[model samples]
Target: MALKAAGGHGGNVHAAARDLRRPIESLLDFSASVNPLGPSPNVLRALDEGMRLIRHYPDPDSVRLRLILASRWKLAPEQFVIANGSTELIDLIPRALGIRSALIVGPTFSEYGSALHRAGAKDRHVRAARQDGYRPPLEEVVDCFRSGRKNGRRPEAVFLCNPNSPTGQACDQNGLTRLLKEVDRFGAWMVLDETFVEYCHELSQLPSVSRYPRLIVLRSFTKFYALPGLRIGYSVSSARTAALLRQYQPPWSVNVLAQRAAEAAIRDQIHARRSRAYLRRERHRFAKALSSLPGLRLFPSRANFLLLELPKPCRAGAVAAELGRRGLLIRDCSLVPGLTPRTIRVAVRSRNDNNRLVAALAKLLR
Candidate 1:
């Protein structure tokens, strides 16, 4: 199956359970990189309280959620958009902008290219080299743009996932500012995916997007709040871009339960703070354990997941399959170019789960 199809593959929590001969309730999946600690007590309580109102359509406009997100980002309600998930908004981006050409950063999300193709986009991909550990090359990108200037051609959109996916490598604030400035100059829009930024406090680019006119930052409650099932995500951008996205809107795209749960989750400061503390500690321990294993090269991660390169002759599929048989799941990333068959990604979860993964692999690698 294609990587896009496989996305919803390993995370079929119940089905994966059945295959392993375990009760769904007894299984813990590390396949999905969702916050192992979340869907806070507050969000749970709100869902319980709001369960009776499911008959009514969600605030059709997602007015309440947008207002909260807008307020949280110090922007007007008109400058925010709520979608079923970041995936939906990701699909909408090309259509909303009517862009025919895009420059996508690879070894990242597959949806960007899939979405672009569906929108009839002429795709231009700059694959990040494993030799460079998948960090953004600002100068190379600028040079590419400059090289294309004589053709009177410029890309319409640039999809940049900060703390980039699969590799989990992030650019510092200075690097991002320079890249965004270059994209902004060529009249290209920056679609900054900050879904994993909450794991890295000072390094987050959410607040920085406020100062750029053409940058659109996408956020999700799925990864941070463990709300993937609810399908809650939103985007922050200029009033004009936000309005354009809304103008091409899908009606009541987000549901009532998701809206309420997310509204509660966003306000749950206690939960957010505790999650940060947990990731800060557990992620360190987890990364160290993975790196200490012979033949695994663990990259630095500001996100809740780590990107790893295994020793030669060890395929990611073989590793993922072995782990899957043990009732554990990790992302097999070899299909992504620039990543060898040895590449795999693991999510940060509870101590017990993380330890299980480390121990399981230590035995297998031997």
Candidate 2:
């Protein structure tokens, strides 16, 4: 199958290589905001050992992995449902929950809109303004819920990406709690995508899943664990709610290697700590370097990527395309609703790669 771009989600190195007629390794991919440190050393060892299990079918229930997750979050095993990736869970949510309409908090991931559309559901957006640094407007969302009847009826669900992509802005737990209260009062489901939360674990709402029955928290081994190739992610909700999602998932969606890799990745605390420390230092250095470019507007980011606005007359598409020609890929956010035409996003990579991108941007912007 030809790997087509999924809602402009980035990390299309294969496609970029094919288009540029260059080897994949030659590209510096700042498009996908994955861990710069790569996967845990333990995950590599686990994959080697797990190769023997490929002949046998993977655990359809993902029992051991769920048990590990349950232990980590101090939740019941029944409250978790492992999947091929968080994207699978995103597609399943609207279908499983009978969500006919949703209010998406944007500008954020396109998958939410695509997933709802695929489910034949109507959706609307409550976007964060650029002037506000793209912080999720939970207040406006609550007002919409309290006021009721947006387009003649209430939304059955609300989708929010905490530490939201492209913008890299996040909401605090208090804000989420307030929003959840409003959602529950109006009898709506809240799907919180915490894919980027491993970088800012303190902001995660995963531990609050038990308290808010209407809340569902999504996580991934792809980002922090740097196992995007493995395609393992899971969702947490009340046991009853989790059962609903599980019924929609196809059998053996997560492979044995992904399951084993996730298990090893989760247990590697030392590596996790090292990865976080590296991102803190590197993201700061990178942001500072990018800020030096004249006529550039850099948004504050808690996550491992930075969102930028190029100088006037410079479109994100043009900048991204130019950078692509130089074998440096970035996310052009111009088409993403709620962002300006000059908007672009880049991942916080290794020191040398980050510096290379900074120098390239400086030269191009000059």
Candidate 3:
């Protein structure tokens, strides 16, 4: 039987466990690039405290959580719009902004295109070449905008995932600024997905949202904060834009426990610093080990995962299937647009878990 569909995304541990006929805890999942260190202790405490709030309705505005996020980013509370997850915000964007067409920078997340299609909006793509190490092609995007303007087919918006998914390549702040300026000149909106920016803080453009009237930065507690089960995320933009997006959201879109957990997660500076330092050290060690495997090409990543290209004679689907039989879960990127059949992605997990995956892969590739 086919594995339960994750809608083309990862982190479906439940589905994988059931398909493998094993306990959920028995599987080593390196498919989703969440923090291996896990959520902050404070978050657990907050969740416990928040359990009582479930008896009442969640704050429709998520006021307390927004205030905490505002203080952390030095933006006003009105500039924030909390949602069930960053995916929810992604779905709302085209509808809220009345976007008719968008230019997507790929090979990246599939949801952007899916969300646009659901809104009956046309979408185009400018893919990054593997020869360029999959660095986000911001320059090409600007050129596309300029050329599209001449052809009278300029897109109404641009979707860019910084420290992008699967590939793990990010555009520098300078390049992002230049691209935003070009988008502004074309009178188009820029939807910047900074989902994994916590792993590389310097590249984030969240704090500068107010300066660019058309720029919307999407962030998540799911990745860095290790709160995927909570499904809490938010966007930062000008107050006017935030209001417009809020208009499209249903009442109580964010639940009580998620808001409380996210509020505590953001306030734990010690946990954040420790998590970043641990990942940096562990990722370096893990990458070195994977590099020793013959015929595997490992891509440099600023995020919490590594993308790999298998040696010839090995396909991602086959390797993933073999690993899955051993209760190891990985993302097969063969079907992701702009990627080759050899490409696969794995999360940066704990030392023991990473070592287990490396050993499994070594034996298979040999």
Worst 10 residues of 2 by lDDT: 1-10
The better-scoring model by lDDT among 1 and 2 is 2
Q: lDDT for every model?
A: 0.81, 0.90, 0.91
Where is the poorest 10-residue window by lDDT in model 1?
Answer: 1-10
Evaluated at residue 195, the lDDT of candidate 2 is 94
Q: Which runs of model 1 end up more than 4 angstroms from their true locations? A: 1-10, 18-21, 208-210
The residue-by-residue lDDT of candidate 3 on 172-260, one tens digit each, is 77998899888988789999999999989988998678778999999999999999998999999999999999999999899999999
Q: How many pairs in model 1 have backbone atoms within 3 A of each other, for residues 3 or more apart or on separate chains, i.e. clashes?
A: 0
Clashing pairs in 1: none
lDDT of 1 at 34: 88
- After TM-score superposition, the amount by which residue 13's alpha carbon in candidate 1 deviates from its true location, in angstroms, is 2.8
Model 2 residue 106 distance off true place after TM-score fit, in angstroms: 0.3
Q: What local lDDT does model 3 show for residue 196?
A: 96
Ranking by TM-score: 3, 2, 1
| lDDT string, candidate 1, 58-128, tens digits | 88778888788878778788878899888889998899899899888876787888889999998887877
On TM-score, the candidate that comes out on top is 3
TM-score of 2: 0.97
